[model samples]
Target: MELKGFSTKCIHGGEEGKYEFDVIPPIHLSSTYQLKYEDQDFVYSRVDNPTRRVLEDKMSVLEKGVASLAFSSGIAAISTVVLSFVKPGEEVILSEDIYGGTKTLFMEILSKRGIKYKYVDTRYADRLEDEISDDTRLVMIESPSNPMMRITDIEKVSKIAHEHGLKVAVDNTFASPYLQNPIELGADITIHSATKYLGGHSDIIAGTATFKTMEDYELVKLHRTRLGGVLSPFDSYLLLRSIKTLEVRMERHCKNAMEIAEYLSNHPKVEDVLYPFLKSFPQYDLARSQMRLGGGMISFKLYTDDQDKVDVFLNSLSIMKKAVSLGGVETLIEQPATMTHRALPDEEKKRLGITPGLIRLSVGIENVEDLISDLENALRNI
Candidate 1:
């Protein structure tokens, strides 16, 4: 009852009914729940599902927020939250370096709908004020941001946004609840692509958005229902199972990543390594101050700018798979310029530091030595 540790919370939180009939939570596969009376707890899976409810509840507690909403995909969760807060002609301020899909949503979809966005370099918290406009309704950011591994000062940015009467949303997919809680850092909402870290093994696709206040929660929840971007009961069940081991898996992931980052930094063929823990990182102090751990992602630029060298490095890898997504049990390596951020124009990609020679590595729970050897061999070929 005391809830002494993270692992304990991971396995037991929001599992109130698991004690009664099932040791493991039952997968409520039914699309609609039978109602014995006019008013019932669950009526439709689209509006609510037992499995998804459990995941939402657990994530809310983990994120230290009032409530959480589940969605069909990460982008769905993002779009719902953005659309809920932002209106036509309203402006949203976001980091220049973010997930490709998110950038597409803001630049392409939201812009087409009359919503404008201001892209700023979030590395300097002071610069945010220059970009913030009267019409800015939301301030979105990704700390330890994707592909580049840049750390933003969430607390400072949240302070700035709150002073301007703007809502702050943070993409916590990179630094999951195990490492950082953005809600506690003064963010109004925390969003996650549960497909990455929360579903740890990379088997399920899901997304979650946690809100600090009940009002914001209901607003997002209503939009989620109306948009029909709801997570399936089966995927919810998978997420629940995966979250039970999140603490353990994240520990291994962080440990392995730090080790690998150090190795890559020392490598002759490596130009620079982007990781939160490295003292050389621009925001090293802030990362240490805000996060419990540096996290599992490592991005580095090769010494050679040759595209062929990059290909050789990726092909030479024996252990790490050349894949697109990250935060899985197995290590994954990919070039963001061509793989993840391929949709962006060349100038925009370069502006975000997603160069052709840049490689992003999602370190896994695999043997650190083996991962190191694999990267070393790959670098040797370069």
Candidate 2:
């Protein structure tokens, strides 16, 4: 039975009802299964696990993909997926506003192995044709990109990439499957750091990669198994439990984020607010076309660039925690220049508008008024 509703899918999508008639899927912790036949579904935990399969199955359905793979971490998923498609000489074209950790992987790790990469503004997807080269193998983007809140047109970019016989992978972490599904928008691959909104409680560290085609799915699964980056059965069970409430959690998250974006936009201390749904956003139309909601991320610049004032504001915050990662039940605030994107060079940070005054907030499913009051109190200090 196919689940038609998003919330229904989250709760019951991958459930097979084969675990001794248990209403909920029980955790299968056996690292090795006793096999009596040559061809068996379960052999080793690294290759596959019942619990992890359920999570992957749910993710595939949620992302509207043919299949999905669970990884030990988000970076591991990115590494496996990229390596599966690209070789040492092949290149990957990336959005300039991607996550800092990704930049490190390409520049520090893959580059040393002869893999080349170039950054471009994917917001204008047609620009890809101008930069496309024979070496280009993959086009990677993050909608409502990390820290900067920039958006890329997935359908337009996917069209251009497909025309060039290239694979398009979208980091769908910021806008969870509830808000957006990259595969539905024509992307070949959709990736997520399930540690975020999928976990909803910041308790687990996991990632997922969903493929539009079974061929890509089988290929990536081979790499993931060889690399031994499979998610543990225990963690998989926890993530599966977390995903059941994803729909309800995201609803509150979006509601709080929209209200917070509006509040910050009107604040005098805030120089500017960057949220996809805001009319003032440079890519508002495109964002609306790609995403169902504004999402829970909001970035704003402070009127003053003084480090002292920034510290004062950060210290004054009572509710929002000053943290690094995002998409949790509790609001988190951070300066990307010093936290998430700090690995990039000074010039790159400057180019991306990650400044001392820039504040990135992952609005959680908290009381809207309380969150706004916390921001107000913090801004007053600044």
Top-TM-score candidate index: 2
Candidate lDDT (C-alpha), each: 0.91, 0.92
Per-candidate alpha-carbon RMSD to the true structure: 1.1, 0.9
Superposed model 1: Cα runs more than 4 Å off: 17-19
Residue-by-residue lDDT tens digits, candidate 2, 234-313? 99999999999999999999999998999889988899999999999998989888899999999999998798998899
Query: What total of clashing residue pairs does each candidate reach?
Result: 0, 0
TM-score of 2: 0.99
Per-residue CA lDDT of model 1 for 1-382, tens digit only, reads 6666888878888786644768877888888877898878699989988888888988987998999999999999999999999999899998889788999998789899999998888889899888888899999999889988888899999999899999999999999999999999999999999999999897988899999999999999999989999999899989999999999999999999999889889988899999999989878999999999999999999997789989998999989999998889889999998899999998998777788999999999999999998987888777
| Superposition error at 194 for model 2 (Å) | 0.6
